[model samples]
Target: MRTCRTRAAGTAVALLLAASALTACGDDGNGAGDGAPPELEIAVGGAADQVTVPDDNPIKEALEEQVGATITSVRTPENLAAMLAAGDAPDFFRLNRTQLDLYASQGLLLDLTPYRDRLQEYIDFVGEDVFELGVIDGKPQAVVRKPAPASYVTYWIRADWLATLGLALPTTVEDFEQVLQAFTTGDPDGNGSADTYGLTGSSTAFNPFAPLWGSFGTAGPGRFYVEDGAVVNGYTDPDTPAAVEYVQRLVGSGVVDPDSFSIDFNEARDRAFQGRAGVMAAGWDAMKKQEFVDAAAAAQPGADWQQLPVMSGPAGDGYITLDPYGASFFAVPASVGEDEAKVDALIDLLNYVSTDEGNRLVSFGVEGTHYTADGDTLAALPALDEDGGYFFVYQLTGRDEETYLEVKFPDEKPFIDVAAAQPLTLVYDSLVVPPEGYTASDAERYATEQLVQFLTGAKSLADYDAFVDELTGQFRYAELIDAGAAQLDELGLTD
Candidate 1:
């Protein structure tokens, strides 16, 4: 075992001296003649139940041995700005790419560019594109956490209902409308009542209409993507209005459920589960979760929901939108830059977890205790669900989502595969940060309300131009678009 002198006084003094003081006390490992490893603080993001890691956590113990440091995990403080101002910040903390840009610009985050060689393993594991999310102005100011395999929302329909109605899977926009018409009027449920609806989904903005927008070769409103060599917001795209028109017709035709305009995601899903709707749009994870699967089975014995491909429209076929850039990132306080030993230890910790052995350890826990491995399959024991909530907190680098999901929820593999195979509208919407003076919440809320109104005939389609004008003019959406374009250009992401 290596030993080093404590630097309590020196650490406190250093903390007190820094301006915009994002500092925390931990062993710097710089004392003469002892040759000891540093003690590092890692700030994880989440609420109390989610982020807490007990002292006796075996994964933490195993990781400490690999990284050659004493690890202290802390929840990201609620009052972060005050903590930073008081020089009581954690050594490193979880943040999103947007927050990374803000802190990097304020000179409150460590630039990891100088230590690239030491962090190569981590950089390679998350891939270059994801790692670049942490880079600002050619300097790596944070570490991007690898995300799971991209998940996209797709249409799911009651296959049994289609069979009962003597209809094959819809392959085009017109075909889909025909199937929906049958589902609504043909009494596919065999109960001889007209209680069924053609479609159901959350009324939250343009999200519920992703496939419809894709049929028109565009994404949902507020999504920013490159088209014809320039960045453009999806709401302002020429194709969006046609997509809106299709939805209006669907609503006006009386095939869509009225409750869809007022319900939340779960409520809309319940409408599907309870046999009130024949179709729904949601991510596979939600649709195929064991609990939900059980709920649907319980509600209707013969309920058989299956993936429905995005129907082709005038422009072309399109898939649901996805943010290629993940939301999780890790940042070190600029104060930690002074301590080279500590910085290297942090890199070592991240690198260790990216290794196959370390990833398995953190993801599944002790092989025989939490799970059993046979070939590439892992069968979880009951103890895993009982005592392993803390394991996820240690998955700082993230796991291969597909493999992880397969191992954890084997029954959902078929649905997962179906989702993986579907086409998608890759959008970089998360990269756009709302500029100062822009109230995004209000703007998004208004847009959603107007969209719902347009869909339900509460507002006429003839006034759609006025809606766009208000969105861009009164909401300062144009400002956001301008800022987003400039930001993407600066990052070399604009095509």
Candidate 2:
């Protein structure tokens, strides 16, 4: 039921491909030579760091010159819905897949399907698998930005405590449990006081022990995986209850920090910094950042925290990897399609960023000033960390993650390498959107409460069947599972 449009006339698809060529493409009355160039209002959002782009920003200037447009970078409006309703939405913006779908459904988004031939360079650069995320209702309504390399959860253990207790690095789940027991009671800190716990982590979705879950061939609850050509939610996976039982045993043994079930990731991290916990599940940046390293050193001068290899279990073992498709997407307003000049400028801008010079310009910033290149390797200058830190907001089309990481955080390379090298458990939740008439938040809350009760022994594992029944009958989880399976199949992701 889907139809495609022919490629628009006069599109400047080859403008940036040649690097030095700045010839105009689509001239719809307001062409560069005819009059003033098209003006594009691009909203910058979703970046954790607040971005302030001055009028003279080199990257912004370069993009405008290449695309033959007056690029105006602005903050994401406080009330985007209101702005869109007022018929004043920004020309381009960043949003999540859900928001993209909503806008596309409302005919507020530009359909890139008509520009498929023009977008060949970008599609080939981003790859078909990841680019598929942009398609909604069988139309390419957004541009899928290929994010940097995925970050993985890692188990950080107190190497000093192991040395003090004369214990070896744990290789298996059983060995890990024994190590936890020793760290709990053996007084590894040498303070001769009952202060330290074996493990600490955030209550994060009520499933802080991700490494443990991974050992059981699953991840935290709410993850989706394909098993034997069937889609299975992690909360109801067969291995999940067994993993929960193991957690209950750990809790009953008092090896896991009780505060872990109550605190957030930051608070859990503070416990590790304060030397109150000997092991923790965290990302490399959380455990090895200079500021955290300094904090740990200040708290316990001789403390040594190191990454522990993934522990093997009866089934298998690995850390849970972030979704490779990425969460944020780039979209253009449907209004832009009304102006051929704007459409051509937008396509030119996107195509340019995916090019070698343009990608490096936006990602690494003005070459020798922000970074230096030696053959294929790029080294960062001090300005890259200082002045160029906020430049990522301009990388609308992501960067080379491995090289970017090496250049940006050279000091953390060892930990980064370790975390990146470990085996990983892949999930497909990002690809599965629940069907209508289902309140996902309500179901998630109900599931979380049930999971917590099971872990805390408030509800016996014998009642797990009852919990699933309630989820199906009360929350309609079965409907969601079926939808997820069908959707994944349609997307060719179940394979």
Model 1 reaches what TM-score against the true structure? 0.85
> After TM-score superposition, what is the CA distance of residue 244 in candidate 1 from its true location, in Å?
0.6
**Count of backbone collisions within predicted model 2:** 0
* Per-residue alpha-carbon lDDT of candidate 1 for residues 328-435, written as tens digits (9 for 90 to 100): 677888877766777777888888888788888888888898899988788888877767777877777777776777777787777777777767656777778778
Q: Which segments of candidate 2 are over 4 A away from where they belong? A: 1-34, 53-55
Angstrom error of the Cα, residue 454, model 1: value is: 2.1
lDDT of each: 0.79, 0.79
Clashing pairs in 1: none
As a whole number from 0 to 100, the lDDT of residue 246 in candidate 2 is 84
Lowest lDDT sum, 10 consecutive residues, model 2, at 1-10
**Per-residue C-alpha lDDT of model 2 across residues 124-232, encoded as one tens digit per residue:** 7787877787888999888888754656567899999999999999988899899999999999888889888999889985535777777787766778777788788
